[model samples]
Target: MTTAARAPLQLPWRTGLAYGALAAPLAFVSLPLYVNLPHHYASVAGAPLAALGGVLLATRALDALIDPALGRLADRLFRQGKGQGHAWWAAVLGCVLLALGFAALWHPPKDSATAMLVWLAGALLLTTLAYSAVCILHQAWGTRWGGAPAWRARVTAWREGATLIGVLLASALPLWLGFDATSALLVLGLMLGLWSLHRLKLPVAQLADPVAPSPDRPQRSPWANASFRWLMLVFMLNGVASAIPATLLPFFVADRLQAPQWQPLFLLGYFGAAALGLPLWVRAVGRRGLAPSWRAGMGLSVLAFAATPWLGAGDGAVFAVICVASGLALGADLALPAALLTGVIHQGGAGGQSEGRYLGWWTCATKLNLALAAGLVLPLLSWAGYRSGSTDAAALQALAWLYAGLPCVLKLGAALALWCAERHHPTWRHTT
Candidate 1:
């Protein structure tokens, strides 16, 4: 058990809630960058699917590579902030960069396809760098506030729950208010979130002081811990499974379901259910422990999504049910992994100092998963003759198989990895 888990700690309710506001704008920007960017460039700017995919692949690859370095920078800021709050300044700078890059992305000054792609590459790189720094800092902040498993669960839930609200808002706003209004909302939310963060008192880094030293407490890399590696293996497998659906959902709904109008509803249902399920999952964690809770959620998701391939055009309702069930599973996805990671960080003796590094690598894994989903799946779909807005039966069939079948297979792999870790890995078993 972790040191934090041996004693009870309670975050003030208001402070817990206030920090979560930051997740909203972060997520607001994410839905557009990952989900909408490809479709926007492909259809609106007339960039070919292959070319757009290449751009995303290249840019996100670079972005993912930068995460560990950025994470180290976040650690420096945390250490420096022992006397003066340099971390806040860094976070503010990140939010500024995020807003500017986001504006430039949606409203590119370029007109031609090549010019637009160039703009996208530059803007996405800038935005993602800023996003990574801020996210690593924010997550590390929460990690420092850790207590028991239930406390960690509550922290993750508040943040991820707010993230779901942000995603839900992002998905619906583009349709209801259009891109201009949606972009404006993102800016507004970013400003407000930063403001709230500025006012909220953050958890102090107990080991952030440079002058302090415990010669016995050497700082090893987060990767030196075997438990972290096993957790990450499970996390990446599960992440790929989740990201595949996210990448394909718009196409599936528009073409496969023939219910383009239901697009917002599907997104809303998924995110909203995930938000609603967060508390329940947290409660489950309190009873079952993190590993069991997470495995149970994974099992539930495989069963729920297995039925996805059977649904057809008029099955929007069925899909909505699938969305809810799978999204309930999403609550576990969002809450448990990070909560378990907190224990891993505590065990690695990096709780206050190197949490940023761990989260930074976690961020890299996240970006890699999205990049792989887009890089591999998009090009493969194009190669298979599945064009956006195409009504070809063969194309649609290929899409269905890739979208629904592939994720279930990946989920099963992730579940098996989790099982093996539980049975064979002593560190993983003891930590939980």
Candidate 2:
């Protein structure tokens, strides 16, 4: 069915906030996994860098590979919900699994290096699986509630804004409150977010919903669409650009800046700017289209990163400014692409049925970016005579290049790809 046939989503700010509540906890949990996990495992547990890299690569790749299947499972559960209990039950189960897995991961159950590695692997896999289920279901639910560009942007903004708050909390809490307390907070946030989610009036799914094409019909893969392929290409490159810095930030702060104490300030500057910039980005989407606005963000990011190479030790103040600038760019990064994807789903007439599938693949790409950053980049840095906590000038310079130079190159590539895609596929403008 065409999008015009469906009941339009009219989300007031209150409803949007309620629907987006879960995003905070999800993002809160993510910071430790991406930003803190490798450092913790390496320093605290004493896992060999190469071995740790290999394990992370293998498990995250495995997780990435399964996202599509998990997406399918999420779709089935969503369909089964049909105003029944399937979706709610699945989400609850996912939350329980996530809490258990996260607790085990942060508070390692074993002391021996080998046992710790094994436990880390198992726990990461479980955490990742639960994360995928909840993420795909939530994304699909939002997609099913379709709306106009500004409205859709508002929905995405609320979620992503909450996500920034979560990231801010995660970044700060571990430094001050410690991992144990952080874990407790995550559990609390998850419970509260889930409760808030139930307050949003979700649309009921019909048995033979037109928005969901018949399962029996020959279905074209999401990749079959030119717009999707182009968008995914841009998303992957942009994601890698963002993920590289994320993977390296702690190390950069500890080594290059020589001020580990400033870590929370940097994170706060970045995420706080992102949260504050969401409203401006939503307005930019209303003025320009998604692709153009996203391209603008890319440009801003490159400009911000361009200054990083010159930053030396005790440049925390300068770095904080960079963080705010890049974080403003991050608002566009977080909000626009997801809104564009929802538009793609509706255009394909697969809003209710295949959103999970599309978003599943999207999740795969997202994980792949993180995997490449942690799995490939870290090991490469190790090979290049750069070790974490090293004060060697040469090693610090190398760290700077990896942390700064690489992302600039990737962001430029993403910007170019976005331009090419928009040049050829102009139809996406109206959708955005």
Candidate 3:
């Protein structure tokens, strides 16, 4: 059951599509949770912004911390029953909780502020926990598929491409169909994804050596691996580079560009470009290998963001070009890193045994990057005299620098680190 034996030279389109289908719903749920939920509570539910933020912060922090545990749970489930039966059941249960919790979150009780706040906390906790569990499980399932570098890139590309489509739908649908209808769509999507998963036959887990850790034996921790740590370092740096712009996008659109009317178009173009570029990046992986392709993406991102400081009120068109270019680079970010992580797991001797653990930490790092972006950037922006609608020249300049310039610097750092990792680190040096 070695990786090469399991991974064929070519993966069927049907198999890739079926394995990736679940990601759409999972991603569909994520957009509303982060972007729309707070707005709904504040404007629609009349919840205090401060109190709402507190509840969200607490619940999300708890959710991120528990991902590793959930990853371990996924590992245990994979070990249960025949093949992935127990894991599949767990995912089904997670989907049920996710749908219910998501529905409840949007339809909060119209009671006292305290009661509504309490309900929000409870619902959010349930939804986020379920989301994390299902997400980690799905990732573990894919990692256990155990493919060559190109096949692994294709696997991640399909999943991430579906995710971009889901994000696009979630972004637009709520505006057109409203929350109730959108929630219904989410439920339906979840059901479809779950059914696909039930029908799909994933590759079985395998170990490089015969005497690796058994099902009952204590598994090695992902943190204990030097390669995992190095990969995470690169991941976190790049993640923060990406997260800063995401956290500041609306403000940048409203104030920097002074064209809030075009915000949707910007988002659409960005994600659309990413989705469209997935194939090209997969092809790039086939040509240049994973680490090199990822560094190239980081380089592309930096070049795209370099023009941001010069963009002003009437520069929306120019900014849109930047979005499209950076979004193309995003294809590599989404597809290659996780593929590299899969290779890391196998190379580190934890392939099938600890895929869940590794992905759990990976998910944790992603969440923490988002959290860190918001936690540090907003306060720093305010301290520098930038506000939501401020037109002050200095303030706007600060916003531009924080939103665009900072990420470029960070991306360069990440790109450098990636190069160093590939050149120096034994675990990362091999072709993925």
Candidate 4:
């Protein structure tokens, strides 16, 4: 590395604010797609439950498979000197797809089942593809120009926090303002996204060293990097746990708690707490290091999930507290993993050079977690004799077990894996 190219790293505040503003939308879009889409399709389109699930399952699975390739494209684009503009393009495309997707979702085919399936598949695939591309590019953009651990942490915090704010706002917009308002909120979000894109000061790729891959290694599959695999394994496990409740909370709240009206309260508490908790987790990251703090958060989640089954009907207050605690734990989930992965990228000799490829795979797993939650778990629960509106004690019990116990089991696995990863220094020490 030449001295000129290795000049001291600095944080760009205008760039950070722009980046943070862009995150406001990314955060809102996913929850709606994963959590609300099913109900929306069922009610608005008159689509059958089985067929709707099948379309979402097939299309999203295909979308997840393509994310790595998209990430690779993003990497080349980033290195090709477009900088953060790649994300801007991806965002524009995402916005277009998402708008079309939502509009289709709002007004389905007259044939009901057939048209709904076709529209859902095409629109979701397009929307998911664009969503994945923009998200990967955005993370890569921040990492490329982020400079240091502290700056990267702040960048991630601002983005994730803003994302939570979007989630909270979107939660109310659809309920309070109606679908028209919902569409308007999304359009507003896209505008902020573009404006933020304009605000970013994308760094020039100064290092002559290659940041992308050979033609043979398109997509830059980080799977070949053994350390990344270890980190991914841990990440996937924990992610599934987090995803389970996110996907099922509506069902559980309505059926088990018998209080569907409180759904907003639950989501608000969870996301709002996560936003507040980010700074505290940042403090923990400073004191205990990213790895240790992450493990601690997982432990907190484990305990929280373990305690979930004890709550009964009219337990909204208790559950709200649970959401707050779990979201507090979520702060670590959001902040540390990326920060730790940034360290991994740095150790893998990537960092500013190859964050897109590295983050692409990370983002891939992240999406799959949601896909599995919605596509796999819902059907599996149905197969197991659990229905959303069931008054049967046995069926309701199944919902609780899935909503809490399963996530607890996954999180426990993650905590155990984290312990082993640290002892083995699987990714960290190996890369070192």
lDDT of 2 by residue, 1-432 (tens): 433443343456787788788999998779999999998887776777877888888898899999999888887887773462677678888989998899889767555778888898999999998988888887777877756666677778888888888999998998899888887888899899888876678754321222555566555788887778988999999998888898888888888888889999999999999889888888888788778888999999999889797788889899999999999999999999998887777666666667788999999999999998888888887887877678788878888998889999999999999999988767456533
User: lDDT by residue for model 4 over 248-269, one digit each (tens)?
Assistant: 8877888889888888888888
Name the lDDT value of residue 422 in candidate 3: 80
lDDT of 2 at 133: 87
**Better-scoring candidate (lDDT), 2 or 3:** 2
* lDDT of every model, 2 decimals: 0.82, 0.83, 0.81, 0.72
Question: How does model 2 fare in lDDT?
Answer: 0.83
Ranking by TM-score: 2, 1, 3, 4
Collision pairs in model 1: none
* Residue runs of model 3 more than 4 Å from their true location after superposition: 1-6, 37-57, 107-120, 204-218, 426-432
Model 1 C-alpha lDDT per residue in residues 37-151, reported as the tens digit of each score: 7877776667888888888989998999999988888888888835327887898889899888887887764568788788889999999999998898888878876456777
Q: Which residue pairs in model 2 clash with each other?
A: none
Per-model TM-score, in order, reads 0.93, 0.94, 0.90, 0.89
Instruction: Please report the candidate that would top TM-score against the real structure.
Output: 2
Badly placed stretches (over 4 Å) of model 4 are 1-13, 42-50, 82-87, 146-148, 203-221, 426-432
Candidate 1 lDDT trough over 10 residues, lowest sum: 206-215
Q: Which stretches in model 2 have alpha-carbon errors above 4 Å?
A: 1-10, 109-111, 203-217
lDDT of 3 by residue, 209-317 (tens): 2233345656678888777787898999999999888867777888889997787788788889999989998888777888888999999989988989878899999
lDDT of 3: 0.81
